[model samples]
Target: MSSILTNTSAMVALQTLKGINASLSSTQNEISTGKSVATAKDNSAVWAISKVMEADVNGFKAISNSLSLGESTVSVGRQASETVTDLLTDIKGKIVAAQESNVDRDKIQTDINALRDQITSVVGAAQFNGLNLIEGTDDVNVLSSLDRKNDGSVSASHITVSRQDLTSGAGTFGSTGLTAAAYGTVNGATASDFTSDAAGKVAEITFGVASLAANDTYEVSIDGTTLSYTAAGTETAADLASHFVGQINALGLEGISATDEGAGVINLVNTKGYETVAVTLNSTSDANLEITDLNGGGAPTDGDVGTIEQRASTIDFSTTAGVNEGDSFKVTAGGSSFNYIAGRGETMEDVAKGLKTAIDSNQPDGITTRVQQDATTGQWKLAVDDANGDGTSTTFSLAVSAGGTASGGLFGLDNIDVTTNEGAAAALDNIETMIQTSIDAAAQFGSVQGRIETQSTFISNLTDALKTGIGSMVDADMEEASAKLQALQVQQQLGVQSLSIANQAPQSILSLFR
Candidate 1:
């Protein structure tokens, strides 16, 4: 029944060899390319996803570059600010030395001027790639990330750094820019506190009675309010005092308190206002009782009793009696200095009044001035009171120097011509402020630089993560591909031999015919 034309065995072998050859070729392609899905046709959905992630990785690399640039720029500004702070500290030392009466202040002032010029140079050169963060009031942005949302939307993340201005040129003075602290370490205007014991004298109302008798009555009057108390027969002087105390306590007068001292004496305290307090007393039953003004009808002579310390800051003009037409004196107080130059026909009184006027010219808030004259000693004093005090725990000092020069520059911190006492005093305070500003700028820049560095590192790590994800989707398993290549090669060889054997079966049919 087998015919030479229809050799089914050979046909089946040929088809099997063709299938094995095709699989072998595909395995070789995978080994060479190292990718299971090298083209969109291989895995359309996975390939598209990997492509999108690859684009993200590239974008993140660019952001890393931007962050590097931003970090470098901030570093430069931070270093410059630190250098300026150090220079300011050096100038402060020179100013402190000038405070000594024996030192040559003019020479120290020259050193101060040189240091100021160097600061100007440092500020001018503090830049990276022509971007100066400490010279202007603009903001710089650094690309930090590419945010991809779940809804298939994309946005960019940026780190914005603001600028700190360190310029000391035009518009930097006269209250327009770079103003110093107006009120430092001074008393503030406050609620007036009245104290009877503040004058260091005790006010006493006395009674001549050896003991209290029945139906004995005494009256106490304070700040225009009077309360009377009657004693029982068994009551002594102490009991009379206690009964009076109970009555005043019941009244609960505002800003005033009453206490009973022993031996028929009463002590009254005024805790309310700055007004002069008047205390009077009369007794209806004690014909022998006596009351007197302990302080001669005024505040207690010793200011150590329950008194609030008033404007106690005093600038004595006692040492200023050697009057000359051209002599000058300088006093530094309240973060500024007041210089007084003696003119013709000006006395120590005029000098004291002149300094008071100069201090008031600053127009500090809640500040009041008084020029007190000691008529007996002919001594004049300038007192400054801060109504609104600086704070509860604030304190300050004043620097007064005499024999000063008439023509020396003041502290713009550049014009610190310490040839005179006034210039040296002003520079001492101004330099402290300048140094603080520089330190603050350095601290701010350091924070920004740290942020940029952190963001840059995060972007680099995120880019690596994305690359690994893309690899997982598209990379070939080389170990599995190598095994498949050997297996497919063996299958192909066997298929070729089988095909040869099947073709020979067709020739056997021919031999049968022979």
Candidate 2:
């Protein structure tokens, strides 16, 4: 145990010193690098996790940049749309002023044309980094987030913004597109006379005295309002008719009057201009009341009734075939042609409205256009009225063609002429529609811009949180590292002294040999 060759005491002190020196060096590295787990050799699991979080933070930073870019693009679009809306509103004011007969409409129209040109310029300039959201129908996506799964996989998330087209291009017509049959069909007479002073429609209802019974209930509904009369123990058909007429007159219905024609006959007259009143008669006993003549004479029936509609020609769009973009609908009247081409995602209602706008551009004298829809059939119709009411007949025809470019969203802005009486009326309606379209586009852009801004803020906060988390996982505790460094240095010095003392023992053994 005390042999000079072994020097066991010195060897043990040397090993202890080596361990102390290694700990001192490690503590010094922690102080210098400011990270306890900077490499795989130092807490590999924590280091890997921290590294991944750092990568995510970097990714989120890039996403924030992307969101900022997207937000700017949308902001440009929103501003442009809002500008267009304002311009359209100004044009509307001019159109309104032109409605007066004494005003100079040519000057008003010049002002409107200038405003429309400004709108076009605004739409053309509304772009950010070559991305124009208000000039096309395509949708753009912005990088919003990096979705990290529990399994350490990541996927990118995006916010999509749709484009709003505000250009005024009239679009080319296609020859092989929608056929005439597939587009729409004209219903009713093409040429018809309109008489505004014509008498209101007439109808008659007769009660059967043979089926009279005690307490029999008779109900009559006119234009959705129902009136009922219950008979006494003994009453003639004349008494019933008189009671019903008094009840109908007492209802104070506008433009409607009823009279007892004696002998169980009740005559109802409609005096409302440009509207028809519906009449229905029902009784508790099926054979008690009969509808004899309603507008036209026919065999008497329990509920048979007819009404004459307003004198207007209709173009009913085909419901069987779907409307495609670029489909053109043309209306020709009095040797003039009015055309409207469909835009993307438009329906037959849009087509009808567009055709109406086109026809109103010229504003023919005594002519008016209205868009109508059938509630039951879901079919859209454009009604052309020769409202002159001078008993003059007007002829109009409708035709559709396919396979051309779609028109801009503001299709009829170029043709908004308010020089004539009819033109002023049409311009007022068309301007309102164009203003609404621009307003809708602005609102859409505003919504998406807000979303992008929110995502950008969230990403910034998320990145900060990630950095804090990564620091907590891998960062060195500087106070603790400093204390440990001092303790390890003292231990290394003590071990070195102990090894020197132990080596002296070998010298003492040599003294024994002396």
Which number leads on lDDT? 2
Q: Residue-wise lDDT of candidate 2 within 1-514, one digit each (tens)?
A: 5787888889999999999998898889999999888898989899888888888898998998999899999999999999899899889889889989999988998888899888888888888999898876667999999999999788999999988889877777767644576678775434432333234445788877754677788888888899998877588888888998999999999877898999989888775544657777777765556675543435564454444344455688888777777778888654467788887778888888888887786666666777878889999988776645455545467778877687778878988888888788878877887888889899999999888888888889999999999989878899999999999989988999999999998777777777
41-148: candidate 1 lDDT, tens digit per residue: 889999999999989998898888999999999999999989988888998888899988699776776787798899878888998998987775557888888999
Winning model by TM-score: 2
Candidate 1: what lDDT? 0.63
Pairs with backbone N, CA or C atoms under 3 Å apart (clashes), candidate 2? 174-403, 177-402, 178-402
Error of 2 at 496 (Å): 1.6
How far out, in Å, is residue 173 in model 2?
3.2
**What global local distance difference test value does model 2 have?**
0.79
In angstroms, how far off is 303's CA in candidate 1? 17
The segments of candidate 2 whose C-alpha lies over 4 angstroms from its true place after superposition are 174-176, 179-185, 189-305, 317-338, 362-367, 373-379, 386-404
Global Cα RMSD, each model: 16.3, 6.9
